[model samples]
Each structure stands twice: as C-alpha cells, then as structure tokens.
Target: MKKNLKRIAIVAMVALVIAACKKNQESAETAPQETVKNADKVLQYIKDLGFPASSIVDNGNEFVVEEDILFPKDMQIPAGGAGTKIEQYYTGSIVSATKKLNIRIFVDPSMTSMSSEINSAIAQWNGVPNSTLRFSIVTTAPYDILIKNEALAAPPGFVTCGQAQFPSGGSAGALVRINKTAIASNSFAQRARTICHEFGHCISFRHTNWAAQGESTATNVPGVTGTDALSLMNGGQCNSGATVLSQKDKDATAALY
Candidate 1:
C-alpha cells in the first residue's frame, strides 16, 4: 500500500509541475496591452500603405511576412522595396547650389521614440561642413504629402525611396514611419541601423548592387549597378545582423553634406 501511495504522490507532483509550467508560459506569451494596441496600429498602417494583402500574416504579438522581402507584422509599410543606387547626373554645381532645406518627419502614433532619434540623425548630417543639405523635423500630416510637393519639381521619378537628390540638383525630402513594437523586438543597434538606412533613402541612395561572394542580383536594368552587402544602401542584413549603417553610407552622406 505504501508503494502505491508513493507512486500516486509522484504522479501528482509531476502533474502539478506541468500545470505550473504551462501557466508560466502563458504569462510569458501574453504581451502588455500597449504593445498589442500598437501592433494593431502598425497593421492598419501597412494596409493603408498598400503592401501585398496576401503577405500579412498574424504571428501572435506582431504580423510577419514569410516571403519576398519579409516584413514584421507590426510594421506599416506603404511600399515594400529594397534599397538601390543611382548615378548622380548633376555634379558639383548642383550639389553646391542646393540650399539647406527642411525635412519633416510625420510620426504615426505607433512610433514611440522617433523624435529623439531623428534629431540625432539630423545632427549627424549637420557634422558635414559645406554640405548644402540641412534637415529639420515637422510633425504634421502625411510625409508623402511633402514628398509629392518636392517631387513635383524633381526629376521624373527622381526622388524615390531609394535616392536623395534629383538630377537637376533639386532638394528632396525623406519621410520615416517606424513601428515601435518592431523596434523593441529587435536590438537597439538593429533599430538604429534601419533608421540610418531610411535616412540614406531620403538623401537619394540606392541599394548596394555591387557583386561579391558570387551573389548577383538584377538591378532595375542592365546598366544600373545594385548596392551590395558592403554598401549601406544594400538591403542585406547589417549592424551585425541588426541593420546598422555601413561605413560606405557615412562616406556617401558625408560626400553629399
């Protein structure tokens, strides 16, 4: 009888342990209310931006894109595209002539700490002496509105999410919209890298298309060289797998500024 009782006790303890573990797991999986609400906002933004509807997949706390340029479930992207590089047609004259301009970052409610990060990014640009480009933050409406206004005077499709200036030396603007949930999910370095990458786009950079390691991807056309891993404009992983800016990016931006 004692043997039977001991066996029963062991089974009961095992069951209790399993139950406790499951409860702990459940708690761990549950995100804070703010995080969940923010994630929903990001999804709605993505939908408004016109990403492929089929790509949206809910993965618990955030939405994830499983194929063809994976995006986090919590990010709202108007257009999903990798970065690219373009030849600067207008040279020294235009670069020297373009005036210091203002750039406004329209923040979606989902972006938590964008203001501080943006200020720091602009300061980085300011460090370049004699560079005509200058930027300031404007929090108002759609960033695209500003892009459209600037685009009107720009080269034909010149101001893209890829590049900064038009061929004519006209100043363009970049608009950044970030997802806070996605930011927290990633390391700080990775998040910063992504911010810098987007900043590069505002300045008119293309994805690094340079070929190395036997990796050859088609650029827009035969003549155009796409950005590569070493190039800050490239869409590949950066910041030690976190997406930080490349040295090339600093050089390129410094050249402009």
Candidate 2:
C-alpha cells in the first residue's frame, strides 16, 4: 500500500511538470508569431504611407526605405493612418509641437569627432525663422535622439552616407547612423548637410524630391509645394545637395511647426 501511494504521487508530480513544460513551450512558440504579426503590421503601415514595395528593404530588424529612411519593426504606427497630400513631401506624422521645441540629441562616443558637424546641423534648424523647432546636445541619459557613427553597408557601386529613423509616438526619430568613413571625403559643408538631412527625417521630412527619387508621393506641407532643386532636404545628393535650408524649406518648416 505504501509503495503504491508513493508511485501515484511521483506520477502526479511528473504529470504536473510535463504540463508546465508544455505550457512554456506553447508560450515561446506564440511569442515569435506575435512578433512576426506586429512586423507585418508595420510593413503594411509603411506601404499605406505610399512607399512603393520595391523601395522597401527588409533589413533584419527594420525596413529601410528610399535609402535613408528607416522604419523600425517595433515603431508605433500613427493612430489614424497615413495622411494624403503629395509634394515637398512629409510622412504626415510629426513631432508634437511641445516636443519639437526642445528635441535633445545625444552624441555617442563613436561620433564625437563630428560634434562640430552635428552642432552646425543643429544650428541650421534652430536658426530657421518663424519656427520653434530646436535641437540641443546632451551628455547623459533621457535623450530624444542618439547620433552615432556606423559603418553602413551598401550594394556595389553605391554608398550610404547615413540613415535616420522617422518619428513615431509623438517624438523625434530615435537614431541617426552616420557612415563617417563614407562621407569623410566630403567637404565640411556636405558632411554637415548629411547630419542636417537626417535630422530632418527625425522630425518627419521625407526627401523633398521624392518623385525624382522614384518614391511614391507623400503628404505635402500646406503651401509648400513643387520641386526644390536647392532644397537641403533632398535625398541622394548627400555630397552635393544644398548645405543650408532653402527659402521654401524655411517656408515648409514654418508651415509645419
């Protein structure tokens, strides 16, 4: 009788352990599926914003579109869906007015060598008349953005000067990855332009010449339209684009902010 009781207890204990293991296994399986599902939603959101399918690259953890704009897998999708105007384009999403007044940039140690360039870029935005947008550098935590040097890769015959994520959740894009080596040969003005351009992305400016870049049209800031050959916000002209914001650029800035 005693032996039977002990055997029954052991069997019950083994059954409980098995059930717990099965439950954990099921949870582990579901987590990846959930992640994949969320990623799909983000991808769809990107498409809905008018980025052509061919322009979107699935870069492991995030989608890289139009060479410079990054859409992270976990970024928050806007609550009401993408906006609809198309020219001198914007993402429709933007940094909230309150947050725009003091967007903080944290320079990673890897990027300290380009501090002058970063400051120059920040000054360009800060100096925009009739706009309250500002960017200040900080040395500690609690920052809105992090600018860092990264050895970005590219396909043959092409180069990636830098990359910036777009704004989400009512804040600026969180990361800017500068390919210092790639742009090292560019002049100081051009380098600063690269940084400034990425900052534009952080605050929700798409490439001003999106149509020429072979991208789908994007939301246009009210009263700021048409091609801007000298627009600093133009992409694919990293080493040769406008180093300072153009008149229309300022107009758009004033209009949006």
Best-performing candidate as measured by lDDT? 2
List model 1 lDDT by residue over 1-257, tens digit each: 99999999999999998898787775754555446666766666544434345656664644432111223333332232222322411111122233445444554444435555555556655554545566655567533212111111113533222112211123332334343443445665455555555555555444454234222232332233334355545544433432434455555555555
The list of candidate 1 runs beyond 4 A from truth reads: 1-85, 88-100, 141-174, 209-231, 238-247
- Model 2 per-residue lDDT tens digits across residues 4-103: 9999999999999889778888465776667788889899999989888998999998999988889888788876767563335688888898999999
Q: Rate the local accuracy (lDDT) of all candidates.
A: 0.43, 0.89
Query: What's the number of clashes in each of the models?
Result: 23, 0
TM-score of every prediction relative to native: 0.42, 0.88
Query: Residue 93's C-alpha lDDT in candidate 2?
Result: 84
Weakest 10 consecutive residues, lDDT, candidate 1?
A: 145-154
